[model samples]
Target: SMFVTNSSFCTESKECLEYLLVCKTDEYEVRHYSPTRWVSTDAEAYFMGVGAAMAFRRLFQYINGANEGGFQMEMTAPVLVKIPEETRMWEPAVYSLGFPLPAAYQEKPPAPTSNKLYFSEMPEMDVYVRSYGGWMLSVTSRLHAHLLTEELGRVGASYNHSYHYGVGYDSPLKLLNRHNEVWYVSEGEGSFTSQRLV
Candidate 1:
């Protein structure tokens, strides 16, 4: 399966989530992802970093034998943090962090022991993607998302602006060539099929 073939940026993991690139230009790319399952947790805080940190720990535990069957699994590439587009200074935003389930466990992932952890079933969909380097901090993620949205608007592409994904492909321990991405869900323009690689 394509999931077993890691892209250049996904050096930290043996397996990575796969997507079919539909189109690419100077500013952004369009990719189609198949339905997949993941282990996920949510955290709410004034900043994305705070929320992601809280949520990451729980998801980490689940992968580190914190499941009902004590199934310890290898980490996957490009962990996803779903960030809401709308938030006020006084109100906290919810960040949902998820780790893609390995192909072996996709059909029957071990149940999480913690109540805060749950399974996420992502449906087949198309997304507008923008790549970046450096750490996926809240500021960088938001900046890139803003830039991508501007380009999408210029191209007259319709997308779901309510939320976006902050994707990280490298671990914090790695200091160079870190790869990240911001994704906006495409609306009605994603029904076409393509097989281009990332």
Candidate 2:
């Protein structure tokens, strides 16, 4: 049996939670992130094929300690990707991918060999999430993101347009019961727009 940690740090809707999922797929998630109080407002939709691979490779090297001491770091859960609106067949729009690390290592993460890869501590947030199964493809990401946006509108739930996030758990080889999520941040108390969702 795999080691399981806490469940449901952020509240979820019935539909969000009911979507079929497999837990314990990723590393230990660190809930407390500092400095970066909230997700930024930017629309970066990574291109599908090599874009994703190159992005991951960059981070992989960073975590593998391509830095000064060569001190390899651990991996974390829910490799996230932010999708874009416009896309073509097999050639998806520009997007971004991310990996979370345990809080213990956040204080002094190894220096990144590549400037593209950097350490960030994400703050707690309220987001509208849509859960789904299967591999995270460009088409799938767009479809679910649309579905989630529509649901929020239908429910009259107010949200900001920070930056939408694609949360993916599990590796490629693990076919059955793959878990994925797209997060739309909720509107903050002020005049903050969320580029993530809208």
Residue 112 lDDT, candidate 1, scale 0-100: 85
Q: Score residue 17 of candidate 2 by CA lDDT.
A: 16
Candidate number with greatest TM-score: 1
TM-score against native, each model: 0.93, 0.68
Residue lDDT tens for model 2, 1-198: 111242352122111111223222232111211222111122223355456666777766766777667876655555666555445555446656666544444455555566665554444445566778888876787678888777777767666654566776666667777777777755643222323311
lDDT of 1: 0.86
Q: After superposition, how far is residue 158 of candidate 2 from its true place, in Å?
A: 1.9
Cα lDDT of model 1 by residue, 54-109, tens digit: 99899888889998889989898779999889989999988888888888898888
C-alpha lDDT score of every prediction, in listed order: 0.86, 0.53
Q: TM-score of the candidate numbered 2?
A: 0.68
Clashes of each: 0, 13
Show model 2 residue runs off by greater than 4 Å. Answer: 1-46, 86-93, 190-198
